[model samples]
Target chain A: MNELHIPTMAQMAAEGKAPEILFWVGCAGSFDERAQKITRSICKILQHVGLSYAVLGTEESCTGDPAKRAGNEFLFQMQALTNIEVLNAYAVKKIVTGCPHCFNTLKNEYPQLGGNYEVIHHTELIQQLIDEGKLKTEDNESFKGKRITYHDACYLGRGNNVYEAPRNALQVLDAELVEMKRCRSNGLCCGAGGAQMFKEAEPGKKEINIERIEDAIEAKAQIVASACPFCMTMLRDGVKIKEKEQEIQVLDIAEITARANGL
Target chain B: MIAQLVFLIILAAAVFLFSKNTGKIRRNILLGKDADRSDQPALRWKTMAKVALGQSKMGKRPVAAIMHLFIYVGFVIINIEVLEITIDGLFGSHRVFSRPLGSLYGLLIGGFEILALLVLVSCVVFLSRRNLLKLKRFQGPEMKEWPRSDANYILFIEILLMTAFLTMNAADYKLQALHFGHYIKAGSFPVSALIAPLLPSNASSLVMIERGCWWFHIIGILAFLNYLPYSKHFHILLAFPNTYYSKLSPKGQFSNMASVTNEVKAMVDPSFVPAATEPGRFGAKDATDLTWKNLMDAYTCTECGRCTSVCPANNTGKLLSPRKIMMDTRDRITEIGNNLDKQGKDFQDNKTLLDDYISREELWACTTCNACTEACPVNIDPLNIITEMRRFIVMEESQAPPSLNNMFSNVENNGAPWKYSNADRMNWAESD
Candidate 1:
């Protein structure tokens, strides 16, 4: 019953000024205050760069991804059509989102629903913000010596092959980056995403996220960073459960980008 | 000679009765599952050929495969030997054709007997590896359901076969000594030499014992043959076809949702609104719901346990066991086949054989990883069956993991499964 929604690239292109850019705010971004804040920061940056764009809010429905994956094809279709109706009404095109799950669902799965859109993750956009010299890092010399390890969300890296964007954004900041043995394509799931982030995992001897977190801790990192809200939440919870919350902080890629932009 | 004739009659009668009872056994297992004839002649023949003859994917262990091959070939070739032995018992003849040691007729019998002995030794190794030593790994639900009854039958046949060979050799040694006078040149055979001192000095009595051993050997074979269609030995006929027509393509390809028709409507239309179909029926619940090839896979498993060993879910101590699923499906299929005449009589409502076969916990434990399918030697895809069951659990019963309920509700209410307020969707972009 996980209702997913997707906005079509074709319909979005035909309407509403073809918004110089589209903001693909995912389910978590719609709900989580911090995630929403990061998304708004990126939109503000686009505006500052003289790029006009439209944010669709919750009119963007579920991506029909979780239902299809859970083998509930019927529910997936309902969510897909509902979102398609919304996009057609607004005449919206193009999208940018902070949530990797929404990004993947829109870029990869929506085409199956006849809603093909050119979707870009926010980190890819943030690097553009830095390369154009439109934004500069804040003097948070506090972050200078901190050893941060980037946890690759499976969807962004393995699922869709968006590996370097997050890392490249992290490089623009001065934090030292550590690497886990299981990184990139071989990265472990944070027991979230694929609707897994919402449901309790099939009962097993170990929590998948804890297992993933232990790998990050083994790298001796002072911070764990990610691009997806689900990974951020799961890893943050994992750090607390492992009693490493204060010792190792979890931050979104956008949070890092915003801080580097001196916001 | 008259005693031998009576023995032959009794052995033949026992075989007939055993074969007759197969239908009953087949029916009892089919309860709770749909039993119907799939109308694909080409598929049936292809499955039969691949599973029965090829056994190409039995396992990775070549030694075990070679040993099993010897037993398989011996079981087939020894049937001819059994017929020759049955005739000799009924007619008071020692040899099928009267001829000297160098003659083709004499040589033919000698070669068959040698091969039979070789197969017997190989079966001993197979038994030791499987049961006594407790070697070989297996996963999935069906592993636990292996009926010990079949093991007993296999052991009894092996014993009878070895005993008959030894006793017949002892009697032959006595006959050679009494008829050919010392027969030192004929003593080259090792088994005959060991039994020569044990055989009675009377030449006619030696021939009588030899005829008795022949009856024992032939009856043993008949008993085992009648067991074929009913027992796990069903794999002896099923594995070859499962291998030959196995999914030659990769497991990653989703069955094309775009091209599939209504009859093949495996997925919901991505373009339409969602509606309820049936309860407890999102995927396949039982055998009939499976594709034609999947049915073939159920019959073809050799119970070798190779697929079970490599399963990550099983190794990690989850309840999903792939071996048990195959065994249970075959067991269920045979039961349904036996009861085909009953016509839609609710088998599950009976609360009979199926209760002990497959469990609900075992069914839900699968992650649909395709690991078991990849590991199977004969290409039996256990994940296919597991996924089919998942469909039924969700679509028909409207039952799934409790967490999925929360997810379904979130997706229904919000555009996604997350529970945040709609107003905050773009808070990130506006934040300092």
Candidate 2:
């Protein structure tokens, strides 16, 4: 808390100071221990790049992604409309999210509910920052030759067709970017989507995340880079299951980019 | 004269049965909920052209695409010969277009003969792939005895039909060489020429053989037309419209329920009381609760199991196969349609798509990953059906899995899915 004085949208509005982008730290980013690291990494990048951004902090609620996906539309819409009213009160224009679920709900679903705003996943923003020469990654020698594979979050890749953005962001890393056999639109899920993370997996011979981890293992990737917070949780759990946590590390794309850039 | 009359009667009966079945299918599909897919005609047409007409998505598997193209192109192109056969059968005329078209008739028949041979080979390859090779996508619990046999039956029918076509051409070529009555030298038969010498050495027997083959080919085609409605092979006809009405929006966006929206609005504004309309069921519990497009998607499924093969639940040995979801939907709808035919519209069968066809366990297993939807060649959305049924389970029956109930409660009480207080949300920011 020393030098990092992150302002909430409430404080920014009260001070009559407008930020360029609203950083949507989704539920996982807000509460999950591992996902909070991704949230911090994204915040570090924004600070390093000198982007004026504000978070909702305590004002933020779950984007209702889990509720909506679980078929509780009433609860989802109630949460969504509350967030929408608060966002509209600030007249926020551009938003960026650390979770694909949040990114998808804000970008695609919120518009019809009268909460239209320019929403982007953090990977897309990071790629844009690199392309614009605002963020330099020439210092990414930490991952110079590490064989890193990216696990496509279903909400990001197939859900919204953002396959290239995350991959392009990885280009900034000097690490070797390997691909799972089922990559891009054909990428396998980590078995945590559609509220499956909140419930016990139904009876199955093998859990889906283990199957996904097996794919990553087959690719011989030393590091599996993730983009979404939910995916980070799933992939980490997968690594733990196979007891390969010491050998194969899972890091979010933002974390990788932040580390590579010396942020 | 009597021969022409008999041909007309057979053709009429085939056409009547075909139309009747097709009409019934249309009616059954329309029995579902209404949804407006008529927006963006230009884009819809383009998508249909690219996916259905061009078969662009089939290129995902190069081997299957080329093999399918052989049959698709052959099926479309060989119909020109069917046209000629129809005219000849009706008027008792031989090679009716020969004089008008001149040498082009020879060129056309030559191409048809070559295509027929390719179709024969392609069907054999397809048959072996299904039976001998047994690709995993073709095997599943949903692909029961009838589904497996339906695929085989279509291939066998295609093989026999193509053979009959070539044999008819061979016998006709031999008769033409002999200058037999009504067998003229009008068409080329490159592939069938090899079999011409093997045909009956006598002219009269060649006539009988030629006529027999002609009857078989035409009859087989008519029967196949009538069989399309009952088989997964219906994809050949329904894929066009199904692709045209594909979900144009992004996959992650589920349609917000208007009923829920009204309730929430009323809670906030108080003055925004919605009209007192008869409330529809919260989610789909029965086949009729699905949208017309969903019902059509069921009929359009080829049971290729592409969706199921890519399904995470199915891959992990879960009971939830997207292919099974679709098959069960189709089966339930067909059953309901039959019940309607017998017992009238007001009659109730007391059966439902939820418990009877698709178990709750299968619905709960889905992660809603969209792999199934992306993998479907015809764009059938099993996710939509899964979600629709989930809505019924959650809202109508309140039968959600116990873990999800806790999640819903946590989100309702706190601001997040977990039980953490909202005050702790910025703790990570402060620590960093």
**Tens-digit per-residue lDDT, B1-432, candidate 2:** 898898999999999999999999999999998888999999999989998999987887888888899999999999988998999999999879899999999999999999999889999998989888988888888787999999999999999999999999999999888888888898999999998877778988898999999999998999999999999999999999999999999998899888888899899889997866446998899999999999999999999888898899889989999999999999999999999999999999899999999999999999999999998888899999999999989988898998899999999889899999989989889665
- The residue-by-residue lDDT of candidate 1 on A1-263, one tens digit each, is 11112233344545634666777666666667656655555655665565666667646667666665565555666676567666655554666777776676666655655665677888888777778776677655747988988988766775567789889888867788889976764455676643555565656676656777898899999988888877887788889899997788888877777665655
For model 1 the TM-score comes to 0.58
The alpha-carbon deviation from the true structure for residue B68 of candidate 1, after best TM-score superposition, in angstroms, is 2.2
User: What is the Å distance of residue B181 in model 1 from its true position?
Assistant: 13
TM-score of chain B of each: 0.71, 0.98
lDDT of 2 by residue, A31-144 (tens): 898888888999989988889999999999999999989989888999999999999998999999999999999999999888999999999999999999988885777899
lDDT of 1 by residue, B61-147 (tens): 678778877777777775665666666667755555433434654455555656666777786776676567766462233445445
Can you give the TM-score per candidate against the true fold?
0.58, 0.98
Place model 2 in a CAPRI quality band. Answer: high
